[model samples]
Target: MVERLRYPGGLRLLLTPNRSLSWRGNVRIWLLLALVSGIIAGGWALAGVWFILPFAGLELMGVAAGIYVTSRNCQRKEVVTIEGDTIHIESGLNRKEHDWILPVRNTRLESFPPNTPFDCHRVRLANRQQQIPLGDFLNNADTDALVHALKARGINILQTEQQPTVGIWF
Candidate 1:
C-alpha cells in the first residue's frame, strides 16, 4: 500500500507491504484448516492408527509457525514527511522503529540501477554522511507517482533515468 498526502506547506508519503489477510483473518483460516485436519486424523486414530494424533499436533504447530513468520512483518511501514526545510523519515518493521532527519537544502535523491532483471530500480535519499532507502515495497507505477509528487513540491531529484527504486519526499 502506498499513500500520499499533500499539504499546503509539504507532503507526507507512507509505504506499507500489501497484506491480503489480516492477522485475525489468518487465525480464522488456520483454525478452520486445523479443525478439518483434526477430524480426519481422529478418524484414522479411531481405526487404530493412534500415532496420527501426535502427527496432527505437529501439523497444527507447523501451520501456526508459518502464520507467525509471515505476519510478523505485515505491519511494517515507512513514512516520509517533508515540512518546510526538514525531512523526517520513520520506518518500523516487526516492532522495531528507526528515524532519520535531513535538511531539505542538502538532501539529494539518488537512483540506482536494478540489481536483477526481475527487480525494480531503487531510489534513496542521501546527503554527504547518510543515505536511506525508500518505498521498498512499492510497484513501479507507484514509485513514479511518488517521484513526480516530490518533484512537484520543489525537492531536487539528482537522477531519474533508469533509477533502481522508488521513494517520496517534498
Candidate 2:
C-alpha cells in the first residue's frame, strides 16, 4: 500500500503502509515484549487475577506511546525535484528543505542489506560524504532504474571495494 502525500512547491513524498519491520525493526524489543506482556495480562485477567491487570494496562500504554512516537519521527517527507540551482530534501512536520548542489558529482547509490546497522530499506545512497537510506522513497526496481539513469547521465556512483554481507529478517 503505497500512498502519495504531496505538498506545495512540487514536493512529493510516498508513504508505504502495512510494512512492518521484520525482526530488525524491533531494536528496542518492544514489539516482541509486547506480545509476551499482552499474553500474560490476558491470562491473568481471565484467571481473575486482578492485581496484574494494572501492570498489563501500563505495558499496553507504553507500547501505544512508543508506536505513536515512532510513526511521527519516521514521517520524513522526501522532496526530490530539479530546481534551477539545486535538489532539495524536506521532512518532518515543519517541512524543512535542504538544498544539494545541482550536480552531485560525488553521489553514489548502492544496494545494502536491510536492518544491518540501521533499520531501513535495502538500498543505501551515498552523496559526497553523507549516506542516506533510499528505501523509503524508491522501490527495488525503481531504485535500480534510477541508478542506471543517473549513471548514464554522468553521475558517478563510486563502488566500494569491500562488499557487505546483507541481512534478511524473516
Candidate 3:
C-alpha cells in the first residue's frame, strides 16, 4: 500500500504491487518479453526435447532475477531526520548525511531527472553547497513532501542557477 513508514528522523514512502503502487507496468513488460522469448526458444528447441526443458528453465531463472533486482531497487522507503546541525537520510540499510550548517543560508529543491524515468526529488544546499546523493530508497513523492514540510517550517529553499552543461562524449 501507499504508506509512510516514519522513523525517528526521517520518513519512508512505500508503494508496492497489491499494496499501493501497482506493478502492472513492470509485470506486463517483463511477461511479454519472457513469453515472446520463450516461444521463440521453444520453437527452435522442439527438435530436441531435452534441450527445450533446460532452455525453458534458464528463461524462467532470468525472469525471476530481473524481478528480484527491479523490486529491490524501486518503491523504497526513506527516513530524513534533523539531528543538531546535520540531516540524516536513511534508506534500506544505508545512511547518508549532510552538515547544513554551512555558510549558505538556503537549500534548493530541484526537479531534475537524469536517466531515471521518474522525476528526481533533490534538495541542493546552496552557496557553496556540497552535493550528496541520497539513497535510492526514496520515492518522488516522499522527497517532495519532505522538502515542502521543511519549507513550511521556515527553511529557505533557494532557486538554483542554470545547470552545468555536459557533453555527450564526455
Candidate 1 off by > 4 Å: 6-8, 94-96, 158-170
List residue ranges in candidate 3 displaced over 4 A.
1-48, 75-77, 83-86, 92-122, 125-129, 134-143, 160-170
Give lDDT per model, in order.
0.82, 0.53, 0.51
Quote each prediction's TM-score. Answer: 0.80, 0.49, 0.49
Candidate of highest lDDT: 1
Cα lDDT tens digits, model 3, 44-152, are 7776654666767787778868776666555444444544444544445223322233321344433443333433545543444455444334456655665566565
What does the lDDT read for residue 149 in candidate 1? 71
What is the full ranking by lDDT, best candidate first? Answer: 1, 2, 3
Which RMSD values do the candidates have, in order? 6.2, 7.7, 6.6
Clashes of each: 6, 0, 8
Model 1 per-residue lDDT tens digits across residues 98-134: 9999998999887665645676657788999998998
